[model samples]
Target chain A: MNSNMKFSRKTEELVNVFQFLKKKEIEFGCTDRQKMEIDLCVEEVFMNMVRHNSTAKNKIQISVNKTADNKIIISLIDHEDHPFDITKTDDLDLEDYVEKKKSGGLGIHLIKQMMDEISFEHQRGISKITMVKNI
Target chain B: MLTIEKINDNEWKFSGRFDASQADKATKELADPSGTVTIDMAGLDYISSMGLSVLVNTYKHLNEQGFSLRLTNLNRHVRDIFKYTRLEQVFDIVDPTS
Candidate 1:
């Protein structure tokens, strides 16, 4: 099954997005661990788009699909192509980060750690991120 | 929605999903504490990076004052989050059930 939603580029809309994913998870059936991972990845990607692409004009579009082979695919499309590839971000050095007490890169770091497969593309004034996780 | 219950002046309990929207609520709830703060995470099933930032900020704030934060009863999902970020070393995490 596949589900899609459009949300405004605002942080406050996170709850709605969360509920949308949860509803789809219940409908599609996933392990608790997979659900949590997908939730975290979706949140990281959605929030990243909302915050970094604040200048974007259109709503963020997200789709969730569960495959027959037990893989969950999620994609987030932002209308404005800001061209920030989260995959290219360097791995976080925890020791140095803790020393400085900085918090900027943790969200992207978590996404990289949790998702099984992640890819990003920016073209034709659209930035899209796709992530896959197996149950 | 996220709930932060003040178990005591130095201890707090977090329940429900702790995501970006709840950051402000968490920050205000954990603003000031004189001693080492202990957070019970038995009921916290989910947490995002923004939620982590709230705790990290609180930890740093308390650290500068010669205090710190302790987290307990983190489930596998939450525990893996700390482990993956390597934040497990930075914060004191203990599980009495183990």
Candidate 2:
């Protein structure tokens, strides 16, 4: 089964999306660790959208699907005109000490590390980010 | 969903989820520290990048004032986030039960 949802570009709406993903993970027989990883990836992407496009009153669309090979796919689409390819973000220097480390790029770094695969696309004035995890 | 309990003047216990929604409040509560500050994370279920950022900032601030920040009782999941972010080397983390 596949599910899709739309919510305003507000951080408060993230709770709803998280709850929905948790319920779907259970239905897909995902373990707790898998569910948590997916939740973290979703939150990182959604927060990036909110922080970058906060001035625009756009809606974000999220969809979840399970592939035949037991892969969980999640897609996030936003109407923000600017394209942000998270894959191209600066590599987090994990070796940096806390006094010198920059947290700005940490979220995307976590998402990249947790997800099996991640891709970004911008077309027709819309940006979409897709992430997949094996259950 | 974050709770900060004062164990003493230099120690505090943090419980619950420390996500984006709670980052601001957690930062405000963690602003001040004395010579040494210990944060108990045994009851913490989850912590996101936002929370980690806050903690990092707090660690820097405390260090600047000749203070130290320590964390104890990190569950497996919480420890994993720190390890993934490479924050394990940045702070003084101790396993109180070990």
Candidate 3:
């Protein structure tokens, strides 16, 4: 599954791209629960990038592929280099941030809670995250 | 994705995300107003602080124009945020079923 797409900082387009992922998942004829999970996880990841792409001059590359081992692999690469991966986070300490809600972290926490196998690879000034969910 | 539907001569229900991401679209679509607008949050799933700021700014803008903005149908998640922020007392926050 070789696919590549470049996106801008536009939030609306980002939303549509997530919907496109949902459509692709449906066209693949996967299970209902799996499809919903795929759609939501994809949406959260993309939205997280959108919320940060502006500071990074709107450079985000996203790829989706279904591996031979029955796992949906989604790769998110961002030009912004800060050495942080939100995909593996498990602490949804809403208590910590609710009173003084800080931007750029909440969405990622939510995404980590939903994904299955999330890996981080930062190289050449780019952060690439690969998330695999077994359907 | 924002729209205004006339519920009555006095109240209009607003649906959609009113955040910084879509604030311009929301302001443009809600240009024409009557007396008061009751935003129905039944269809809204999530919102951010930017969205809350947009609502506060919109409330101020509408009030300046003699039209009040009242929020209704705020979901539990959003209500929690508002309650945490002590804004539930400031906003109407009508029941979702209504």
**Fnat: each model in turn:** 0.75, 0.38, 0.05
**Per-residue lDDT for B1-93 in model 2, tens only?**
688898987889999878888888888778776677899999988888998989888888887898878999998878888888888878899
Weakest 10 consecutive residues of candidate 3 chain B by summed lDDT: B81-90
What fraction of the native alpha-carbon contacts across the interface, defined at 8 angstroms, is recovered by model 3? 0.05
Candidate DockQ scores, in order: 0.76, 0.60, 0.14
Query: Top model by DockQ, which number?
Result: 1
Stretches of candidate 1 above 4 Å error? none
lDDT of 2: 0.85
How large is the C-alpha RMSD of every model relative to the true structure?
Answer: 1.5, 1.8, 6.0
Per-residue alpha-carbon lDDT of candidate 1 for residues A26-86, written as tens digits (9 for 90 to 100):
8878779878988999999999888888987789999999889988889999976557888
Best by lDDT: 1
Relative to the true structure, candidate 1 reaches a TM of: 0.94
**TM-score values for chain B across all models:** 0.95, 0.93, 0.69
Classified by CAPRI criteria, candidate 2 counts as medium
TM-score of chain A of each: 0.92, 0.93, 0.76
Evaluate candidate 2 by giving its C-alpha RMSD to the native, one decimal.
1.8
Q: What is the lDDT of residue A26 in candidate 2?
A: 88
**lDDT of every predicted structure (CA atoms):** 0.88, 0.85, 0.62
